[model samples]
Target: MTTKANFPAAAGSVVVPYGHVVGNEKWRGSEIAQRLQGKIKLIFEDGLGLVDFHLSNRICILYISEADLVAGDDFKRRLVRFRNANSLGGIVIVERTQISDQYFIAVQKLVVLELGMVLLPVANQGEASQLITQLVREQSKDHNSNPFLRKQCSQLLEASVFRTVQQIPGVGKTKALLLLQQFGSIHRLCNASVKELELVVGQTVAQQIHTFLCS
Candidate 1:
């Protein structure tokens, strides 16, 4: 119902403040929107276009009701149009009631594989609200708090670098350590001249290292 140009700034870049969500005007009093009000800050805006909800600047949601699924391929067309028009990561939330369960697999394949977007199934709007709340909570947390996003410490990085250096032909722990001391990273080690490498290992091994890396 809304157009892309009506957005505040960039396309698909809905700047939602922390612990808040921007919802489409179409869902002003919908059950999911109503439920979300108690859990997080829900702000209604017009011209959200294909997005039903904006979780963050980079993430958004497109809701497909059970009726939409049963109606025909209109939901698919809507998803395709959204994919073509927006750069934001879309999360498709579909109502998966017993009646709509039959179409779940087909919908999943279309939304996930073909469209390359996330597809989440909910029994009803209540469940959808709960899932959305969890998603917003996760998004609000510090990235380090998430196990998948926790940064690899320098010690682990150095160990990984150490192992990678040993993979070079004819280089073992001692030589790997020597080369690492001379060249702090694999990029520098790969770029080292034979004369440069000779400063770390002997001239004979240096040539071998240079050839192994370059060739």
Candidate 2:
């Protein structure tokens, strides 16, 4: 997945979990890890083995392959771990092969919506690597912004009801669902008073969503 990339490291950078360093020639962790090594802070394990990588200040990115997605309940648990974690940037699903309907539906229902996962499925590892590098660069570009490519956000908005909720201005899936639950439906949420919405999703997001619905 190695390719030419230009990223500038700044004050807040990525924190790679575990001791798994990106290999030089082999590039075992894929080109994304290799390219991001110096640009990001690679936190080698301190005898406490953790997950693949950790973006403490940045959003969490998970490298999910179709094979991994179909790997029974064990892999499902792994996916759960990533989804439950704090501040997820995106989940890059590498499709070396076709993902079956059964697994695909499960992923959509179980992980994407419920956890507000920003899902991006790439054709191969190369695309995944490039996209990941781009995300890192975008994060570097604007420190106080959501560092998602325009295309990524568009795809997410089109994916499903859950994703659409996640795209409502500052409305993440969790807060969106909470407001929906309180109001009983999306239509109700749109019609809900700002004070009512604020009780569920907070003042800023509530106002943003009310404005969004009106617009």
> TM-score winner among the candidates?
1
TM-score of each model, in listed order: 0.62, 0.48
What TM-score does candidate 2 reach? Answer: 0.48
lDDT of each: 0.74, 0.52
lDDT minimum window of 10 residues, candidate 2: 17-26
lDDT of 1 by residue, 39-133 (tens): 87888777777888887776788999999999999999999999998877777888989999888767765665356566667899999999888
* Model 2 per-residue lDDT tens digits across residues 1-215: 22332221221243333222221222335555655565544333222111343343344445656667667666567666655554444453535456544465445544454555555657666676566556556645544544444445445534554555666779777876776568764456657889988888889988997886666
**lDDT over C-alpha atoms for residue 110 of model 1:** 64
TM-score of 1: 0.62
